[model samples]
Target: MQQLTIVTPQPERPKRRLPKWLKRPLPSTEMAFTSNVIEDLNLETVCESAKCPNRTECWAQKTATFMILGNVCTRPCGFCSVPKGKTGEILIDEPERVAEAAARLGLKYVVITCVTRDDLPDGGAEHFYECVQAVRAKTGADVEVLTSDFRGNRAAISRVVEARPDVFNHNVESVPRLYSRVRRNAIYQRSLDLLKQVKDEAPDMPTKSGLMLGLGETFDEVLDVAADLRAVGCDMLTMGQYLQPSADQLPVERFVPPEEFDELGEQCRKLGFSMVASGPFVRSSYHAGEMAAEATS
Candidate 1:
């Protein structure tokens, strides 16, 4: 008879255990204080939203990367831990609240990032401008805005440039080849174009971009991406080991050693970047104020 053989599906392999260097100490009381400020003001931070490995360290130091708009992201990138779905009406008071949080935290420099709000008309660029203005007016702090691509809208990008934040950051997140798997809805070239546009409009602005290593990208591929950033006038770069946030996210392909990150940082410096931060715990905003100061100095 034409009976077919039964097929058995193989089980998925277990995730690799984190290396010793990836382990962080438990959150301190200062972290609780930072959490209380965010909670009291109902502010959102990428540190918490993305399940960042450096949340405890950053918060304990009384610094945070504020996430404007809302917590729900519109993109379903494979590696992010931020929740994705439809969001409510934009929080009109968010800018003011973010200002208050920075003031209360006694911050001299603030970094504001947002979820990809594709639902918004300007991709939440106006809100970013408002937050930048609000924080500057409220605390007189140097502001850095890490923004989404705004669907490649030039007008929207211009509006943010007009706000005149101290630093402009947009993370490429991964190399071009990995876009389909790592950044599902994002276009690699589109991101590069956005950075270029920022520099085009505001030539003196210090533009920055970040990359998450350990997602099966080659060492040469990482350097090529750094070169791409430099070609667009990107001034600062941050590279970090990508840790899978959870079981649902993409698994880690490799654990890049600490020395590799150091070497990459050196190479990027040779490519004419003014500032480079690369390490297992390096996020776009980690020690961001210090990096900005050194770059501008």
Candidate 2:
């Protein structure tokens, strides 16, 4: 039997202190409706659950991607802070609540994602579709489904794509060689195939993917990923530095400077992506709609 190394590396301390410009103010803008929407819907969000640094900024703007299915994911990925094991049963009414939240928040766009439901036969694809439909029905906003591989279920993937969300997103997270270290039970080629399938299946709806750098990935690998994404017809690309949210999560390899991020943006543009969100703090859904709109224009 092959012995799994399972080396739990210590979280690397931030190389430098936060510059004044990098410091973010606390979130004082409370949207009571936002709280009510999430509470009423009983949805789990990476913002609140994973302790994303931008949760305050995103929520203060009255925007949040509704995490459906359940908060608990089936896979215990090395880099993720989301708790693992024992994902609860699918919530039938969660879709309605997400729609109600989007409608109540007056959101012009809604981004939805979920934990990987490996136990489910369809890998929660139908559930993602139902939520997108409900959000559209209730809010009438352009929807973005930031999804998983649906465990490579083509029919399940089609069900979500056929729902026709304005944007379809599936993040590759990192380069192929880092797959075992970054994502558990997720194949790099399979993920690329998912993006390819989205491009083939839903040509009109913009397809997007993202990767987190500073995970020991090289400049060449980053460019290679950009080429691969463009090859799969991914319309938008986001590259950001990996910030370890917790002690147990993956550590940052090296702090990438903002200039390097800018360079990456230029490389992404050269690789055929019209839109590239590349920065130390930029995330896939941060200003997603506005950034995506630029690509179409």
Query: Candidate 1 regions off by >4 Å?
Result: 1-10, 27-29
Position 115, candidate 1: lDDT? 94
Pairs that collide, model 2: none
Best by TM-score: 1
Q: lDDT tens string, model 1, 132-172?
A: 99999999999999999998988999999999999999999
Query: lDDT tens digits, residues 33-59, model 2?
Result: 576777876778877776777887788
At residue 92, what lDDT does model 2 achieve?
A: 92
Candidate 2, residue 27: how far the Cα is off, in Å: 4.9
Q: What TM-score goes with each of the models?
A: 0.95, 0.92
lDDT score, candidate 2, position 252: 76
What are the per-model C-alpha RMSD values against the true structure? 2.2, 4.3
Candidate 1's displacement at residue 243, Å, is 0.7
Instruction: Give the Cα RMSD of candidate 2.
Output: 4.3
